[model samples]
Target: MSDAHTADEGRAPRRVLVVMAHPDDVDYGAAGTVARWTAAGHDVRYCVVTDGDAGAEDPETDRAALAATRRGEQRDAAAVVGVKDVTFLGYPDGRVETGLALRRDVARVIRRCRPDLVLTHSPDRDLVHVKASHPDHRAVGSAVLDAVYPDARNPCAFPELLHQDGLAAWTVPEVWVRGGPVTNHHVDVTDTFHLKMTAIRAHVSQGGQSAEFEETMRARLAALARDAGLPDGRLCEAYLRIDTR
Candidate 1:
């Protein structure tokens, strides 16, 4: 669908929840935005669907060890931007699917957090970031979107979560899609850009330490800021703002 936008359509959400596919996913795309939100006293939580076990390049890498390593890295990275609570769903990396089970898991978090704003990858595959729009990313985006809509708002859809888990239904007013192929909204992250880079660099197992990775990210964010019509040297994160409700 083409992006439809209303500039500053509503006030910034007071409570934000970020749900993504893997350990480094949020930091890579929306950490700066998260920093901006937290600095403004908004409550933000991150939910990672995968354990990142399959992120290693070498076949000899231990999958179990890699998953554990990535989890710790995510926590440290989140801390850099004042996000203290992160939930890891522990699904196998590269094996996520957009299905009922995944939807239920994401819905549970939504019901519990009851966030007004949700941030996630584009539900559609992003041609712009071919590598980032992995099978896992697509799956999580689809599931999270499902969770945000009727599922989370309708307790009848997931009775187990309501009856067994005692989590009530929640209505999230809006969802912002990060790294979409088309962008209609942007967050000027000039002040928090350094914090974002620091958070991204915490993912040591995922090339966060590579100079090339850092350089590429800087260039990308700077370009996004320019395209967003921010000051020439400003840094920003772009999104397609989706009003889910």
Candidate 2:
């Protein structure tokens, strides 16, 4: 895992595809890195697998309204980081599965984007991150991994994609999975921490107790950076890097 993405100086993936289960999923761990990537001229696109209709915990929360709100919030969040392309698969939130349908959808985006790198959720469900390892997250991760491999790379895997959509096969070189038991890569995001917070703020429905959440989030970021071996006061995002090639 460590060998897959050692970040050779000045070498960056030309195009990056980020796949996640819900609207704010990517913002939780990788928003800062996304900002940094876009700042460096790397093209990053987001593929959100679900509408996140089931995100609100309150029984009175209007699911449909919440879904629409989340989608708009996500678009705003993406724009904050300079990302213009965001694809919402429109799958039912909290019920996504690693089925052929999910694979096909992910494969379509991968082929269309032709990204050299893909970032997604970790496949494993560690005890430390039971919430992050939600079933929907795991399902999306498994499907994304499969789609990045044979489904997106093999021309014959989904013939309809070629005959109907005109998408060609695409082979992605590397995938970096966020939030797992083992972290092999750390993206220094000190300079882009503020941008990350701004992006996170776009999800107005997700935050709580403004002052408390902001303070807690800052502390969490600091702890994450320290645990990931970053220099003092530097912000970092950890990932389990995998070589798809």
Candidate 3:
């Protein structure tokens, strides 16, 4: 962890690519910060590794239909934050693995997006919040990290992308990881907290619309804001900021 502060300032509008394991992962983790970025004119896109086919609490649910529904919900959620473009890789919901195939797929997206920054879950597990350290989340995070380093930047790693698809190698300059063990950056999302809540609520299949859920989320943000040294009543979203440049 570096320092608890906001993101890079005074930079021009940047292209940001967010990679997550499931549909509402971004909303639960860093939607507030993302809202702030888009409000500042950044171009943000999402690459959801899975369509959340296995998210339903009921095991008898139709997974294929659930996947389609979740994809639509994610798009609606993204629209609330001013983002439009979203890609779903259609990987199995609960069985994601940190393997070469996953890395290659993420690398392909990185090369295509050519984003200045990549945001994703932390590869590390959080003991305090075990749910944040889901296997799929860690797997996707690890794959994205691998893709950001050598795979996405090295054209030799995926020859097909160069010869067949013509997606030139792209180097992501920075990465912001959510649900990490430590947070070095904080975004004051008091202004856009409503937007974040709206985005979360858009995932109707996830059932987060209750007043108690909102209260719990508010308490969590308030605690994080205090950790960030923000004044009282301020809401914040925190991340582990890493410089890949």
Candidate 4:
């Protein structure tokens, strides 16, 4: 869809939720697009499935410390994208599951956020490379999709959330999955690319030559934009739209 259509459509989402498996996943995949959404006056919330405890070195580093550090970094990243609320499910780094429990947690967030749209990883995240795809990504995506469907929208499911937490039933109208083969939507993020890069640079504990990774990340995003037929010199983020009609 074109930028003009996104701006003109009356149905454009006012509240958006982005669910991802790791702290930096959204920054790498969709932070620029999120900046666009927030700039358009939409409320954006970020939900990270894992604490990223396994992402750091220094064997003596406690899991709680790592989690705390990551959470702060995530919040900083969200701020860069103009998102004010950020949540973490506290699931383990590599062991997210697609079961009733995870679904319930995700459903609770969906209901509480009352987002008109949700964005998440592709269920088939291993399509590019088996070893490259993190298992947590697929698991979180599947659980989020289930939550957005009959679980979150249905008042009957996860009754505890409604009774105990005061979260109401909510049905998000659209879901956009990133890292899919059939990318049908592109968001012009030329104005937000630098913000995205800044967010990514905040994850300094995950040791690497910062200069190298940043350059590589910029090149990759540029290539992705080009592959999606975005105009030259315009950075973009791509996604596959799924209507929850």
lDDT of 3 at 49: 99
Off by over 4 Å in 3: 1-4, 7-9
Q: In candidate 4, what are the lDDT values of residues 1-245, reduced to their tens digit? A: 43231321244558889999999899888888887788878889999999899886577889888899989988987888789999998998988878999999999999989988899988875566453257888888889899999999999998899899999899989998887556777776777878888877777666533778767766776776687667777667777788995
User: TM-score rank, highest first?
Assistant: 3, 2, 1, 4
lDDT of 3: 0.92
Better of 2 and 3 by lDDT: 3
lDDT of 2 by residue, 78-185 (tens): 999989999999999978889999999999999999998999998888788688789898899899999998899999998999999999999999999976778888
Higher-ranked by TM-score: 3 or 4: 3
* CA lDDT, candidate 1, residue 194: 86
Clashes per candidate, residues 3 or more apart or on different chains:
0, 0, 0, 0
The best candidate in terms of TM-score: 3
TM-score of 4: 0.90
Runs in model 2 lying further than 4 Å from the true structure: 1-9
| lDDT (Cα atoms) of all candidates against the true structure | 0.85, 0.86, 0.92, 0.81
TM-score of each: 0.93, 0.93, 0.97, 0.90
Model 4 C-alpha RMSD vs. true structure (Å) is 2.5
Better of 2 and 3 by TM-score: 3
Best by lDDT: 3
